[model samples]
Target: MRRITVPIALLALLGSAVPAAAAQAAPPPSIAWTACDPAEEVPEGVLCATLEVPVDWSRPGGPTIELALAKRPATDPSRRIGSLLINPGGPGGSGVDFAYFSGSAFSPAVTDRFDIVGFDPRGQARSHVVNCDSDLIGAQYTQLYPDNRAEYADLRATNRALALSCRELSGPLVTYVDTASVARDMDAIRAGLGEKRISYYGVSYGTMIGQQYAELFPSRIRALALDSNMDHAQNIAGYQKWESLAMEGSFRQFTSWCDRTEACALHERGALAYFDELYARAEAGELNPDGQPLPPEDLVNIVFGYMYNPNSWFELADTLLYLGQGDGGQTGRGEPVPNGYLPVMCSDFHFDVGAYPVLRAIEQAQNRLAPHTRLNPLAWSDLASCQNWPWKVTNPPHRLRASAELPPILLANSRWDVATPYEWGTSLASQLPSARFLTYDGVGHGTYWRSDCARAAIDTYLVELRTPAKGTHCPAVFPSSPVSAQAVPTVVDPLPQLTGPFRR
Candidate 1:
């Protein structure tokens, strides 16, 4: 199998060479720790700090940027391992806040064994942020998945204006907010911590940073656990197809549950047909939920958002029922729109603005193949933004590999994830020489924080360096059954599994 041979190939490749800078670099300046502002949503015993890293790694002593940090020291220092840095995805998500939020909830064993560390990657919130026009961003977001050639032209113009605005507001820093730069920033943090190597836990987009770090400084990793991965090897078309199919797959699973379970609020004999009607009405602009009418694209996005977790399916069912009745209220709970997502994603991947027609045709073909969940506006928006982006990416798309001398890493993902998708995690695992994959056969974007099985695997791996056997699957906690919807207690949104802690 390719998976079996990849590690062997990577080991040979890594063992043959080393990065000269990483090999001979001196420690950067020490960080100054202080009490976090009381007004900030900080967990107990969390101290704040800042590290100065180069905006451009090539010129280390040139322009500098401050990266904010948060730390929860190990409860039992005598038994403590070194610092374990954590990033909760969002190329934009604030790691500093994540330290306070997730760190506060870490199990005693983990808190006692390792210092929980988190940092806002350069150009993210709490760091030197990339500011854009709030009004323009809100207005243009989700506005450009046009229905006609004329509309497409409008989309292009809108994108051009938005792109120009972003560049004007963001300046040169926007071009440098790539994953490669973020990885270098991680190394700076590692050296500042006085650790020979550091452990890491990265979720979603955060995994990209982890992968890059492992490739650039393979010998500097103590341990790594990547959950809900985003495959950096995917080009624009591949990215669109993968995400569209994943979203559709999750939608189909939700409908299947409804077909078999009476407890689902939207349970009916022809559930898929009912959904088709909703989609048609949204497309025709004949259905308005609450006061605003949702375009077919926005409607699909709403449904896709609920696909993040099975527990939220009931809410999704209710939303569909309301739409069926020509009533509109709030849809089901959704993930917070990322502020830093566009800047970072656009900067990392290559997108061709001139290829919009061809790309849209390809997307349409993919949609036809998967009609149940078509109109993937998320992919469209990302590609469009990148096409129109005024800045160049300092770190372009690339695969990742760990040096043979680095510690083996762990990866976890739910089998039915939509946001980052399960296959992305598998893809990442295959590419890395020392990666072990853990699968959760459940519904959610992330697994480690919510699933005991996943958490146990990660904990054992971090504490004892015991990798889970390949092909291991964690059983789902909530299995589908036809029961009363009201009888089952609804759970709080699991979307916050990563984003809640670091939203400052």
Candidate 2:
């Protein structure tokens, strides 16, 4: 699951278009956005504002970047607590927008009690997007069972294509995508709002932002809930290693779900057989209803895309049902699938256009880490993009550990999340002596959105400032149904010709 930091997405555009001086100067008494007609699509209570912060804090007198801010006044102004920040996960994702869109995403209590705030960290959507040249999507390496040198060569060409694409479109911000800048922006936002302290909820990459924010401004934090925690404490290599294993485990659970579900397509005991066959079909240029060739990884991406939300689980099952049935027909999958997932999946994490070779080497390194495990397409894409990206190593070996003095944080994780494994949750949470780790025996990525237990625990923390006992690690509590119980079952001809079931 390639989650973006929703610091932008959830907030949308809420705050006012004030002069940049406010960010450089002291904050206003309370947050407010310019009055405009709120559209049906926009959140009702959202207010838009801008925070003028130094583009480079080191050069305070230098040029400034507009830090987007969105605020939703406390549901009950009489009981308004304070500005509560929300981030939706992608470092590249939107957070400022979450303030506008997170109405229902947050638990009822959190929304009712605190004034929600979100912002796009610099270099993300609506906050100052960074780009490079070339169509990284078309140039990406597409090896099905990337087994031999021949496949690697083909992958190389595609990787090169990706590099050229990202490089051409990118400018100065490419080198400034580091999280420190984002943390600084958060501080500026707090200043702009005249808040002594900040409250935050971050997921996926958002957790990394939260950790950095908390670490940098320990005294500035009122409360924080970081879900699907990012391991800034670990090296990028280690991060990818753990994520690979996580993907393997999650895919296994996915297969198991297929076996148990009446709606899933691969019902046999060894669903791997069916998967192999399906990939082979795609390699031979299978077409879906959209008349586009369905690459194997494309198939994987569609399935991987929705693993973040239980709301999307049935959609995945439905897709699988079609894939299983479509593979049987001559036109491949008869109907189109994944129109929405493809664009973002293809273009979102694109690498720089010139660093094609770098992308290839990065992928090579990542794939070598777990030669036998299932790898997330997005996971590999990150490494590839980083390799080709113009960004430099400011905190490349980002090993910022949580401080012992911070208040107890509640860390949540899904055992079957391909993006963040349970190990990461416990591992990082362990570093923060004040933190209490919670696990859910669920599939897909992230907390909340679908899991009630996670939402309840997080909401309680956000609203009540209560948490699981210190060092009180909760066992993995999954939905009552087995992982695969909700998946549908179908009979697809297994590939008997396939060798020892492919490891990945």
Reference-based TM-score of each model: 0.87, 0.74
Segments of candidate 2 deviating more than 4 angstroms: 1-32, 36-40, 134-137, 140-171, 263-272, 280-293, 324-373, 470-504
Task: Report per-prediction Cα RMSD to one decimal.
Answer: 7.7, 9.8
Instruction: Name the lDDT value of residue 110 in candidate 2.
Output: 76
| Candidate with maximal TM-score | 1
Steric clashes per prediction: 3, 70
Worst 10 residues of 1 by lDDT: 1-10
Model 1 Cα lDDT, one tens digit per residue, 279-357: 8988788888886787777778778777765766878888888876865533332222235667787778887546556
Candidate 2: what lDDT? 0.59
lDDT of 1 at 129: 77
